[model samples]
Target: MILILFFCFSFTVDQYIENGRPSADPVVVNPVMEEFDPTKKPEFIIKPRKQFADEGKVAKFKTSFEGVAQVNWERHGQLLQQNDKYKMYPALDFHYLEISSVTAEDAGSYTCIVSNDVGSDTASAVLEVFETFKPSPTPAPKKLELDVKLLDRDVLEGTQQVEFKCKFSNATTVYWLKDGRKLTENERRKMTFDGVFAMLIIKDISCLDIACYECVATSKRGEEVRTSCALTVKRDKQDCNDETGERSKAPEIVSVTPSDLSVKSGEAAMFTVNHTGDTEVKWYRGRREVEPDDRLIIDNKSGVGHFTIQNALPTDQGVYNVIVTNKWGNDSMLVRLHVEDTSIFDGRDVKISTENFEDFYILQDKVGKGRFGTVHKCIEKSSNRLWAAKIIKCKEKQKPDVRNEINIMNGLTHSKVLRLWDAYESPTGFIIVTEFVCGGELFERIVDDDFVLTESDCAHFMHQICEGVCYLHAKNIIHLDLKPENILCIAKSNNLIKIIDFGLARCLQPGDSIKVLFGTPDFIAPEVVNYDEISYATDLWSLGVICYVLLSGWAPFTGETDSETLVNVTQAKYDFDEDIFEDISELAKDFIQKLLVKNKDHRMTIQDCLKHEWLALDTVDGQIMKRLSTDKLKTFIARRKWQVPTPASSLKQSNGGGPSGKAFLNGGADHWHHSHHHRKGHMQTPRSSSYSNGQVPWKKNGNAIQAVNRMIGKFSSLSSNSSISSSSSSSPTSSSSLYSKSKQSS
Candidate 1:
């Protein structure tokens, strides 16, 4: 046995030397397992432990055998090196392998071998290496800084082409997002990408095309950038989609031009349309076809047609009609142009007013008629501007007066002063075009639609009037005909007052007085009634009368005849009846009293009117500015009209019958004629009492005034009075008639 052992030891040493293994130690084996023992094969209590570790973590694999055993470790069927990175603990009954700083390179199938005297046992496990480290909360992803921008676009509805584009730098791939979501190929949207641009093409754009679009660009380095913009799609509300597809080709009105447009002279006016399908566009001014010239331009392209008029004039103000025609159908739109008078802006320093009378069309109905001329509503064609065109026949006696009126109008530039746009010579002598105050008379506005006139409203309008008059006074011009009819409201929405009628306006030096009797009877000052000197004080007296009428809706002075009216005016016998003036502020009464004083020198100045305590509503007791019942005032006037005698009979009675009858009627003839004409056209019923522009004398004070106020309450059942007098539009001859007739009759 000893000999056999020596031989085996010698043999082991020789084999170890042949395998090139270090041989500092002797080989040890189990003496009993020198021969194979089938019954005592090795088994394991603990096999290699499966491990999950991070890139820099340590992984351990261990195993223990139960029966008599020897253990060894191998990697990928090859012997493993036992060093600092990989270490193995080998024992008689157990063995373990540990790898520190585990790397992807150290991952593979590792096997453990166990041996007994009879046979060996093997166990294998796989080590999977993932690109990711031990999981942690993900850090914020890096953002791309690529140069990218999206261009915005506007498109019309119906069969239209629309595109969205994005420009980028160094883009690897590009895509689109519609309304915050990824865009894809669909029936309505088509997306494409070029070298550095991304595009979303939409065919047949509709209201649905209105959306925000985004373009996303990604680089080869995995960086991403994006840009976005909104798409505006305008569609015609009336041109709805055909449910049955029957009116597909019909030319429909997309949007009609504004029903009314007010343009200043020498400005441009544009009318535009958008419709579906192919069509031809035609334009007309009144009944005449519009031919394009240097001032008139027509543009029709890509479903849009535009009509523009440059350098618009008073003659350009009128109703314009656009006719759009196609094989399917035809449609039309009307635009009314209201041209503002620019002639008032002309002066020594200003340019000449447009004299093209062809721009304006005169309506047949006359607003006023007198010895001087007739006034008609004229419209400018291109701008839809409205003007009061006064057609005057050339008379040898009226030339200087007309020239003076024009010169005064041309020199004034206050916003509250009526603007005279143009004066043109024609076969009918001359046509003076003035701004059309669409809001009508100030009294008319007060009575409209249950509108309650507050003291603030009064102050507001009064302030404007004072400012305009102040401007006129500074220029040494006096408006002898200032009245409710002459004071026109700028518009219905506002209380802006514009003083009209320069025909009665006379530029006077300070202290200069005109002896020729002028001004309406009711509004004429005491000095004028006494045949005294007429100065700026006369205008103040008229303003006081207007204020009284506005507050109480009754003339301050009224009588059965012009003589009685003149007597009351000359005496300054107007009184504020408490019943009618109960709501009026004491400050307002004071203001009116100051103006209506018998002494013209003591009357309120325009400056004093502006500084009146009544106008200071913001600082005074709020109760004083309470709203007045305009309904009550309108009702009172309606009843007074029925009670008063007919103006025609009164005028005829004042003047004996004459062939000319030129000076045969009293001053009330103009007002009566204008009121009657207005009533015939608008108010078909028994007309309300006409507010005379001439001497309107009230009954002797006290009980008489009380009787009129009481009667007004009972007259509340009458219909709305639609009549508006254009006494402010009278000619020079009629203007003087008011003063001359009152003086003659008295």
Candidate 2:
């Protein structure tokens, strides 16, 4: 019964255990375990330190994590990118963030964040980017100070002289003042400054001279310093005597020495007169009273009065009067003083008047024009004589050259050289009045169909040129440019020639080494092209080239281009062409050869050339008297005219109707207009041709001979149809209008 009860209890217990236990299909044992915890949230093993960097440098931030995690970088609370500017490296334990080329904007707080599935750990650091260092600048020196201290003084009335002195330091200018009014230097009052010392002298001081004097000094930096002094005048015995009214005798002139006097400029002149009785003496120039000054002095003592003039000038020439006055009467004497005219330009006696040019002359017609100005035929009003007026526009900078030319021409006196009659200076220009030449240029006569030219005639022309050149050389002057265009005839019927146009002339002193590069290409001397020392012989070379051209109607050194011509001149490359020079005498060729030498020392001088047999009229060979053909000369003149750029209107106005007529006696009316080429500074022979106007054709391989042939062919074809006027006008009709027309076209 008990066993039955136990089984039932056990079954009951089992049923209760089964009902209370968790549901399972089979019985199983569960392993014992603790509560699970995630890996400690990533802890920073090293915190990023603050970084300092300069502009354009690199900055780095690094940190190490205690556990595995993802890493990121942030600046100014913004996530950073791994690009050219920012770079990041993430590893299991180390993390790095790098920045390149740090700038001012890169300075900020940088954060390193490490995160896992649970949480994140972060560290922050500050980045500082500073500008490159630069040192401060030094201070400037202080300005200088000026001291102008003066002393007070007292002087008796009628004192001979009273002076006030002062001193200054580092002052550029100083001025004196009387009672706050500026004091001007005059005859009685004189002001002088030497170095740092200054003085003001008052002569014949009177009661009116009492005043407050001030001196103002100006520093170089424009600062001003000033000081003042008082001047006191005391009563003299002479004033009391005048108030007492003593009886005075009448003044009478006893004798006056030298009633009239004449002196040269810069010379001193004195006049003395004797008078009776006590009197006050005074001197007068014209109607103005003469006072004592640095240049004038007057003294009266012991019944004698003297008036003196120092460093007299032309303006001082006038009538003078001396008067002696007493209480009873006065005596006066009149004297005439004249100061001769002096040289005003470069020690040369060139008198330039400032009066109106129109007052002395009447402009009749416009005859010539050039780059400088215009020329006109004028008639002198007083003499009714014809003269050519060259009106040169004198710019401020160009006045010196014009004045130099005037000085040179004024000193020259020769029959073969053109004469300078007068010169006047105007506000805008200069009017140069010269002798009137009715004839035209030498080449102009050669180009005439009816004109007859012989070797003797050429010799006569050269003789005149040599005479003029010899005269110039005697005065240490060299006419560097000698050409046919510069030779002028006195009249159409006369054989006399005048050498004109001294524009390129120079007055060289002994031992002077001056080199200049300027002249026509065809006539340029070898020394000119070589930049050698120029002497009197340089002009002889040009004369040689002129003779060659006159004989052959072609320039000896002329090539297709100016550069080639220059090269040929430098090498002294020229030959007497048989086609044109066959009839020319051997003596003439010998003269040219002697003068055309490359060495200036070996070149024939003007005096030697004048003695050559070719120039001697008595020794002229029959071959020299032979008539030369004018066809080549006409071709030359036509080619020259064509080469000169001309306006269309110039063709119709060839008969002295154009502005370019024979206006000036000087042959420079077409100076710049006909200049083939004018080069300055150092010269270089070009390997290729450089055509200035684009009218000339380019030559292959710079073949000068081929180019010359082409030019001759081109000009020869047009010579038959070219009817150039051979007027006796010294002006260029085509080139004169060219300058204005070119300006208009531009």
Question: Cα lDDT for residue 51, model 2?
Answer: 95
TM-score for every candidate vs. truth? 0.47, 0.42
The lDDT, on a scale of 0 to 1, for candidate 2 is: 0.64
lDDT agreement with native, every candidate: 0.60, 0.64
| Model 2 CA deviation exceeding 4 Å by range | 1-349, 618-621, 645-746
Top-lDDT candidate index: 2
Per-residue lDDT tens digits for candidate 2, residues 414-452, read 767776778998878688876555456677766677677
Give a tens-digit lDDT track for model 1, residues 1-746.
65675565456446434344323222223222245344777766677766676677788887766454555668877877656777655434335677888889878888988776677888887776554556898765444454556666655567567877767766778888765468789887888887666788888976455555778888767887878665655444244345765435557667756656888865668888776668898776533568764346689886788887654666677667676767545566556678897643555232233466765564533555545555665566755555566666765544555667787887676778877677776444667766554445677678877576777788777778888989999998888767665677655434666787676677777444453233455666666545455677778888888788777777778654444555577668878888878767788889888988888888888898988877767533665557777765676445432333332222211112111111122223223211111111243321212223322212221111111112122123222331111122223433222111111122
